[model samples]
Target chain A: MNTKPKILIVDDKPENLKALRKVLKDLDIELVEATSGNDALKATLCHDFVLALLDIQMPGMDGYELAGILREEEKTAHLPFIFISAVYTDNLNVFKGYENGAFSFITKPFQPEILINKVKFFIDKHQQEVALYELNEELKNANKELDAFTYSVSHDLRAPLRAVNGYAEMLNEDYGTHLDDEGKRLIENINYYAKKMGALIDDLLAFSRLGRKEIQVSEIDMNEMVEGVLIEMNKSITHNAKIKIGKLHQVNADYGLLHQVMFNLISNAIKYSSKKEHPIIEISSNEKNGKIVFSIKDNGAGFNMKYADKLFGVFQRLHSQEEFEGTGVGLAIVQRVISKHKGNVWAEGNINEGATFNFSLT
Target chain B: MDYEVEILIVEDNMSDAEMTIRALKKNNLTNKLLHLKDGAEALDFIFARENYSDRKIENIPKVILLDLKMPKVNGIQVLQELKSDERTKKIPVVILTSSKEDPDIQECYCLGANSYVVKPVQFEMFVKVVSELGLYWMILNQPPK
Candidate 1:
């Protein structure tokens, strides 16, 4: 009776309770018995029950009144109640039972098979509701935990990375002459990887921040952003080639995020073109379908179109490590930036000819 | 051609420290070498007297090699501490790190790191940096003696 189901069986005769238990024992259910309506009402108040089998005839509180009281209480109101009256199956009794929150009626000389099936239906449905309720709460808590963890990573992880890079650089300058060529290069690589890892962390943080940061859409000058990106790009891109600056159009977008988009697209053009014989980079933007479309084309080691779907995936690189150098997050960041601005990004390329990236802001 | 440098090398990794020392030595400037592991140890070495009570305060190495990533004290905090210290206040601290992260480089300079150098991964390049640093800090420039 006090098992998993937490069922409340109310009947004046103990014989009826014993009979119901014998029939439902095979099903994994807990049965609780109350001889009178008063006892049933008291039991429902203290414990959660999947279903209550109420006896219509009772001494102090009648089944209808008790059921009405249970229905008034928010806690036990939704519990499925089955009324047992022994009184003939009359329309008035059934209508009143229905009005008082009785799910259905069961005659005193109950059919064991029919009762078992009906009780099983309600019990299974109740278990499902409970499972769903618990799952929702668990999911909410997990999301909150994840948010806190990301915040810690955004701040704490960077301190150590900075230290690794700072001291390594000092070693290079203060001890350069004393080291052999290979020795110097080793430290430089360490410095490089540390920087690479640092960029990875920053990109991850930026992507996470994008979810919450308010996107302030304003008119943005793509030409100016492109030029600024070019200046920054010049610092790291070890490439010598002809870069043609096309006419850029202004767009209604988040200025900072759009700048990031342009920077990523343009620099990617230069990086992929590092090995090109005549590396030519073209930047142009236009209004397409009422959206500002920006494109960056480059003559470089292009990727196969079959793998095009993976282009914007975080840390997804199609090329071998020896062929290209990057954190593989540039395109992903660009995608995020554009997506945040209510835009779309796509890439077109062949194996060796070149690659062209296009994005639009709406 | 000689120079006495108040140099601070802050480095966390030991192998890098040894390599840096080797490079500086090869450049013929091994008379002064101060190696501190983490930021906390570096601060204690430079600021607290009882920390390095066994060593002479006057003979503090002209250059301090500082590593940024350490358990307690990190490179930036150490730089801030050194710049603020009267005794080792003017010492030229160079940041040598394995990271090419821009913010790390920018922050080091902002915190008064004298020079920022990215450690090259290849052995040959690392040796070149070490030698250049030795030549620059030891033989080329003179510090306030």
Candidate 2:
């Protein structure tokens, strides 16, 4: 809904205002006339004008002071200025105009085309700058809204989820044997579904939070990180699985986001290996070019490599909800964390044999 | 005004209210219970004396169990009025809602709710919460005189 560009004519003379308005009447523009410098300052307070045409030799708090005040206000700091004076002044006045953040100085008894061209130039530039500023503000506001949503999910939303999980557990505990088998199964399913819903909400919140969170770039130890991930994995690793580690190296990245990448990769390795006999999982890190490259290998039931591109999409799970239990947010979280830290994550796997997931931080 | 009831459940869902009552009954705290189906009815009970001069309104419930997204007068409005009034100011109100929106929680607390609780989707966990709430508020907490 952007309208016509605005041009403010600051002068005590009504005829000059009307005449300038007449000259620029053919173009898409708005001409606002302020009789005195004080009036101009007051006018600028409300309306947004693209170019301010100031009469330099007018009354108290003249052109220069008005420009200075406009510059001081963050709201109007970048509003373009042009000094329109009908004075037979010297080069010194011209020099003074430039010093006061004036874009151009048009002399008295100026040609109509010259005034029109000069005013249009600053107006166009100002319009572009204003548009950019508005866009930036919109982006900031959207990010803030997302952040608030995440905060709500993490704190407020957890209440009902807790209630669901808590109450479901109570039902089974209090009257378990009294309830029929179907009823018991229903209650268990209810608990299972509630917990799964809670997990989804949490992962979504984390994904949204990653958008605004700052990334601290530094050298992170891949060896220590892999070990830490392995330690966390050990608790959940119930099967006879073997993890083979290759020579690891250091890489520049945000430690938290990088840790998230490895954590997800290793967890997925463990998750898909439930059916395999003596599941073989291998971890390796190496320096490729100037960037750090890392991979996780698993001898498990793998997905079709053709659909590998779809793996990192949000809520995209390769297997059915019944076959593999997941929120379908793990790899998506991994991809996002990697991307936020200026990295990329991808995988290559064929059914039955194995899969290799690798990423690079640039 | 002096309220003798220990738990005041303000809820619109009949099934949920029944489930909640069953949980409370299991813990043996159903005798002093007062259940209202809607926010408007709850408000009427709280400010009951205004309509019926002969029937005196009790001071306030020992603890008010509030549901946020109810018909007519919402839970937030109820909280605001209760907190603002000197007579009902001391009564602890807990917000129970399906919505986990931060704004709902903030608005509830901002209007002076004592605690916020979200309803679980699972019926069993909901029963457990009901049982814990019974044990906690009825047995553990010392209601204001």
Candidate 3:
């Protein structure tokens, strides 16, 4: 890898190219010189130049024409140029040079300091852009690796978990008469933990799988969706909470993902507020700041405000497993789904008071 | 190699194969079951080549419970080879693997797999799934003669 930045200097006169080289000699760069416009185009093909210094008074192809041709090429389209002109030093000619996409214009008998400063600016800008491009490529590769890891976990990790659970069940089934009560209890514990681990792996896979799933947007009736969630929850859970649902606005979003979001939020609200006597749960939506903000508020064991930021993180739980039986992936999944839709999710809570989970869809 | 086979299970994982056999045994469906270790061996046995050269190729199993991920050759390749062959094309192949990936499922179906079932992690669910699959394929399904 050539770490030194390349600069192309083009002029009709060899002396002029020499003068530009003498000016840029102090800078740490590789200079490629061309005496004609055609040669400059050829030089661009050979090297990825950070900046091009062009003389405007060439015979066959002038500086402006060369710059225009360079701009047309995809590789050199964004290449910055310093236009040097002895003939077109006037305001009109300078304006024409600027129209031809000149980064900086220098009149002939140009000061060495001025040329060096302008060359240095573009080189710095090019270096910054290169750094940013490298960073972006690294991030893309990292995301790909994470997805592959999650995929393997989904496929390979569950096999061992299934084996553990299966053998324990076989032991219990085949030798239940021979084993004592304590031995049977131990086998049961093994099965229980294996099942719990299986659930955790399933939740983790679901969360990671969301990253790769493409969003298919459609107009969803929020009222109907919430009603469906409530009906399903009522069937599965025995909760005595007083539920209230306000008019939810219809929004364009992925149906399956949004349904999951609603399910997670509403379920969290119900579970957290289950211990409260006469627990009150409210589900509402309204348009604010050109976004439909839907909220699920519950009067339950509200978390401390200090740890609110940690609520949506994967496996991040403010409450222990004893207080709430959860895998802690629900909110993380909610955040991922909402963010993928280009929306925002947040929560407000205080100790012993209540918690309100809100999300906005555009 | 010479025994009467009704169900052929091609699975590389010993534990998984054992559990599957136990599940089938519980339902009295393992009497004529044959378990091959990998796709290569399964292919050899089905084509009546290599070690099982004495077996007749015309004696096809009623159901082949195939695992997707295996050494030498995978389930998709096995499904492709079987479905493309005239003699083995009629045999029902049920893809039993741990992968629930959409692409894998789609590819299996595209390769002419009769069924695709994700292996459940829970022991009881695994047992139930295996037994039900055995009962359905052995009893309910009428194979082409």
Candidate 4:
């Protein structure tokens, strides 16, 4: 039923065709034999074959003419062929066989094992190529689905969240004095939680966007980027945090993406250590193994080492939302941005001992 | 005499429109502000066509606050029509919506949007934003003759 592997062998002599058939009879393969080049071309149209064995010397239509015909047809253009001939085994003829797309050639007194091994190699290669093509099609479909998901998250989800926050604020601003203390507190909680959900949605959108966004690499000044981020953070974080900036080196990266990485790391450091009378955060960089490694060490609420692997995962939190106000997507975004830059990121921490986050770029 | 409509807010969400109007009222700017439900109504109001034929076409609003995603028509289409027409091209347009997608931002400006503001999730911040926008577009910015 055409399920079995097929091979075509063509020759002008009956004895030669018999020998070729006898050699391949042991294998579970269908063998089609042709006595002339025209007959070989006709046989190829009827059955799909893994390999073709062609005789260089033939009657009206020779092996080269048959191979050229098969190559012209779109269906058999990539069909593998091996030339077998007793008369045209000279250098010029053999070179012509190769130029016509013969994968390998077998002479009249060729070894049986040599013919079998060459056929097997082409069969395996064709199978691998088919599998790779299927995999690529699947990847393209998956990316299309991901794009749709990111759009829904960015537009559909945020629209309702904005309404919830907006109306609640309106209620509180217009009717706060009319309500009792408990009523006022309840409205405040509602607004706070709504804003929290909005923050989570924003983080999710950012994380998904990194999947499709292109990264533009440039030379970034580490010192200037860190200074700017710290200044921005200070406006929101009113803690007695003592930040120390060590000797930092310039890096080759996407400026905006790497800037987000620095912002996330330094913000985490400051947040986890806000309880201390004087929160100490240190930033440093060094050259290692032809790559620049930067580290941010903070004396804050550290985590257990057992869950270290979950640190970079989306929505993975080492501390409760109450202890640290974050959507847990900070580290996940940091990891994704660094990985897109072809870099590595990891962290080390211990409970109540503070945590150190490190990333490297080459 | 033709009525002067200083601010035109094109928003589909009722609560958002109410909140925006309240913020403008807090600054005593709601006296001449007009809120339409969607881009279609806003277009009708500005061009003095269909239901708005009684309104004078010369009395254009000082600024248009457009939202991107709407039911009948959208902000981009409205902006395109406004910027292409000679009578309405000189009026300023501000795109205010929840979408922060980069493509939307680029497209809005390409369609002649004067400014783009992503709505903040915090109510207090939203109130502050609306008030500032009203002040800037209604009082500060000058329109073409």
Which candidate achieves the best lDDT against the true structure? 3
**How far off is each candidate at the interface, as Cα RMSD in Å?**
8.5, 6.2, 0.7, 1.5
CA lDDT of each prediction against the hidden true structure: 0.76, 0.80, 0.92, 0.87
Give the CAPRI rating of model 4.
Answer: medium
Q: Compared with the true structure, what per-residue lDDT tens digits does model 4 show for residues B55-109?
A: 9888788888888899879888999998999889888899999888899999999
Model 1 has an lDDT value of 0.76
How high a TM-score does candidate 2 get? 0.64
DockQ of 3: 0.91
Better by lDDT, candidate 3 or 1:
3
Question: Candidate 1: where are CA atoms >4 Å away?
Answer: A1-220, A224-246, A252-260, A263-282, A297-306, A319-327, A348-356, B1-10, B38-51, B76-85, B98-125, B139-142
Looking at model 3, the pairs that clash are none
Candidate 4 yields a Cα-based lDDT of 0.87
Ranking by lDDT: 3, 4, 2, 1
Worst 10 residues of 2 chain A by lDDT: A153-162
Per residue, candidate 3 scores C-alpha lDDT tens digits across A1-362 of 34899999999998887788888889999999999999999999989999999999899999999999999999999888899988788998888888888888999877889988999899889889889999999998998789889878766889999999999999989899999999999999999899888888889899889988899999999999999998998899999989899988999999999999999999999999999988999999989999999999999999898999999999999998888888889999999999999999999998879899999999
- Estimate, for each residue in A1-362, the C-alpha lDDT of model 4 and write its tens digit: 22667889999999999988877667767789999988888898898888899998888999999999889999889999999988877889889888998888878688888877787787677667667888988997898688778768666877677788777777777787899999988888888888888888888888888777889999999999999999898897777889999989998899998999999999999899998777899999999999999999999888899999999999999888778778899999999999988889998989999999999999
Candidate 4, superposed: residue stretches over 4 Å from native: A1-116, A221-224, A238-251, A277-279, A282-293, B1-4
Weakest 10 consecutive residues of candidate 2 chain B by summed lDDT: B49-58
DockQ of prediction 1: 0.06
> Candidate 3: global Cα-lDDT?
0.92
Rank candidates by TM-score, best first. 3, 4, 2, 1
Query: How many clashes does each candidate structure show, in the order listed?
Result: 80, 13, 0, 0
